[model samples]
Target: MPHLTIVANIKANADKVDLVKSELLKLIDPTVAEPGCVQYDLHQDNDDPAHFLFYENWESRELWQMHSNSNHVKALAAATEDAIEELSIYEMTKVH
Candidate 1:
């Protein structure tokens, strides 16, 4: 299976960013155990606290689709709406 990479960038108001980070961390275990998930990790930029990224590896595109519609992700969206100033998601495959 091919690897998947998700780049999630966000800008939040003050501590709201931390709140979003906390919520995102809550998703780690469930995300890792999902059907096609091979690995899942979340990272924060040291120089820019407002920047965050979620690195995920999936068995296939199908599994990613399932993850997008899952209840856990939905809950995360709900929890983060108030905290997010801007959010962008990039889905791509590794070139090397």
Candidate 2:
């Protein structure tokens, strides 16, 4: 099966950046342990502390979907509902 590359872009409300970061951090360890998760990395924009991104690689889309529906992700979504200014997820495939 082909792998997937996921890029999640998140923007937190200026005053809520810390809260958003905390909630997102909660997903790291668990997500990395999920089956088929090749990589899961988080990054904060230096020029804009409120902007954050996740660079992830999954062994398959099915596993990625499972991860998306996991409880930890649900909790993060709920926790940041009000604190997030913008959220977007992109799924990609690399070409040789």
lDDT per residue (tens digit) for residues 4-90 in model 1: 777667676677877988888888988888898887878888988877777777777788889989999999989887888888878
> What C-alpha lDDT values do all the predictions have?
0.82, 0.96
Q: lDDT tens string, model 2, 9-44?
A: 999999999999999999999999999999999999
Per-candidate Cα RMSD to the true structure, in Å, reads 1.4, 0.8
Candidate 2 residue-wise lDDT at 51:
99
- What local lDDT does model 2 show for residue 6? 98
Error of 1 at 1 (Å): 4.3
Q: What is candidate 1's local distance difference test score? A: 0.82
Choose the strongest candidate by TM-score. Answer: 2
Candidate 2 regions exceeding 4 Å error are none
